[model samples]
Target: MSLLESWDRGEHTAETLRGTTATYATYRKGSGPGVVVIHEIPGLTPDVIAFGEEVVAAGFTVVMPHLFGRPEAGLSPLAVAGAMRQVCVSREFTKLATGETSPVAGWLRSLARELHTELGGPGVGALGMCFTGGFALAMMVDESVAAPVLCQPSVPFVPGRRRGADLNLSPADLGVVRERAAAGCQVLGLQYAGDPLTGTRFDTLAGEIGDAFLRVDLPGRRHSTVTTHRQQEAVDRVLAFFTERLS
Candidate 1:
């Protein structure tokens, strides 16, 4: 059997989330508070969906947006490369630039607002991984996004020292995010200490958000926290953060 076939599964329904400027196909499952799971550069693969299922099992509505790649495509080198190429040229993502939020973040914020309106909670949760990781922080400018989790956020490609610490947010957006953090909204971040792609963004987050940033820095070169690298402690921490914030 395929590795995906052996994992825990949940019933999910697919829907189109119509945003102000874009539309996304979203897979949703479970119930309670809403949590949007933004996949990495390679799209919404099986492992990403499995992580979403874990969120659902934790008693929250999990929405996985199909950013790129085949939804059920397992981890394949070719698939990852294709998705990376697409992201590199797509106007939606800010691939090799600093001090700018990706255009898709606005759409994600819209999705979160709509979900919060429909689900009726204190606010919604957002978890972004890899290329999309800092997006959750960008969404935090809006009060509707209460729980923001960034995992291995790599953007502007981390080619230099400045890009390494850039949060991929515009000045105005960063200012608002800082204000929100000061207002008592905590942000959770997870990453391996030795991952080059992540750079020193965690330090930037800590410096900007002060005590409101809770960082879980694992020791190693592993990248993906919930998959690939697969740190159970990180996964547990994420679940606990969600439960504490979303519940």
Candidate 2:
């Protein structure tokens, strides 16, 4: 059977949201405080959807956006290649660029604002993975995002210290993020301690945000902390963070 079958049709309510920067379809499920679960590279693979479902079950309304790649596509070399091509050429993402936030982050922050307005909670959570990892931090510039979870944020993609340590933020946006952190907005980060894709951004985050950044440096070099790799401890930590911050 195709891994796409993993998306249970009857469970999620699909809707399209048009933002200032972009328009995309979203799958929403559960009911409580809201959390925007951004997928990893290669699109919304079955693993990513499964993780969203798990987040839903943990008592929050989860919205999974179809960003790039074939929706419900499984992770294959071809699919990954195709997605990388799109990201590389698209202005919505900042692949090898430094000191600039991806343009798509504005759209995501709009989505979070709408969710928070609808749910009327303390705030909404933004969970970004892999290529979209630094997005959660960018979205934190908006007040709607109170809980930001960054899992293996690989961006400004290139070798060397400049690209490796870039936080994928412009100078102005980085100031806002620092203010948010200082104001007690806890940013959750989970990754394999030695994952090269994650680079030294974790160290950058620590230096920029200090004690406000909650660090979860797991063992080994496996990339995806909550989706493809799907660590139970990491998931638990994520859920606990959402509950503490958003609930």
Candidate 3:
């Protein structure tokens, strides 16, 4: 049997997307406004796929890229740990930088642009979860990304006071983000009220983007507001946001 055969691809068609730095297999499904669902660490677990289907059913084309790990692996502790190790060493990810965005965001932007070009809408939406959560924010630098949703954005290894609030963006990039928000691109953020993994970045985002950063704080200390923890309210709000923005 093929190594990839064991993985359930569901209704998504396997394709390839290339950018300046990286190229990866993309599983695309649905037809309408495009939404790029970037998987978190541990790769595209079943949890993420289920959520992507949620978006697809809500009337948006969803493309999930297999960034690392087995495309369809169990969401075991070992799987998460293994993916975390890979992310820690991967050149595409910026795990501990205070003022820079991850390199993978570039490729994500390219994907969003390609989707927008194909669909011919105002723009496409980009939703990043957990480890890739802040990536949606970085993808906002591009004009092709109209709707950016960040779920429990944990990045720059926010342990200290400085990194805790870092936006995982360079000064210039942060400025561009601010400018984009000023020009009317609203950024949606979802997370728990007390998620330590998310640090103080929400406060930082509020301070940086002002009212343009729509904050949706769910109750509890859990991470993964949309996937692992699976908040219904958060999920509803996400679909609504896509409807209002992408639809």
Candidate 1 structure quality by residue, lDDT tens digits, 148-180: 999999987877999998999999999999999
lDDT of 3 at 113: 84
Task: Please give the range of 10 consecutive residues that has the lowest summed lDDT in model 1.
Answer: 11-20
Q: Among these predicted structures, which one has the highest TM-score?
A: 2
Off-target runs (Cα >4 Å) in candidate 3 are 1-20
Clashes of each: 0, 0, 0
For residues 1-247, write the lDDT of model 2, one tens digit per residue. 7544444332222222223345677778888999999998999898998898889899998888788898778889999999988888877788888999888888888788888999997999999999999999999999999999999999988587899999999999999999999999999999999898988999999999999999999999899999888899999999999999987
Model 1 stretches astray by more than 4 angstroms: 1-20
Flag regions of model 2 displaced more than 4 Å.
1-20
TM-score, structure 1 vs. true: 0.91
Q: Count backbone overlaps in model 3.
A: 0
- TM-scores across all candidates? 0.91, 0.92, 0.91
What 10-residue stretch in candidate 2 is worst by lDDT?
A: 10-19
lDDT of 2 at 31: 87
| Clashing residue pairs, backbone N/CA/C < 3 A, model 2 | none
Q: Considering lDDT, where higher is better, how would the candidates rank from best to worst?
A: 2, 1, 3
Model 3 RMSD, rounded to 1 decimal:
3.8
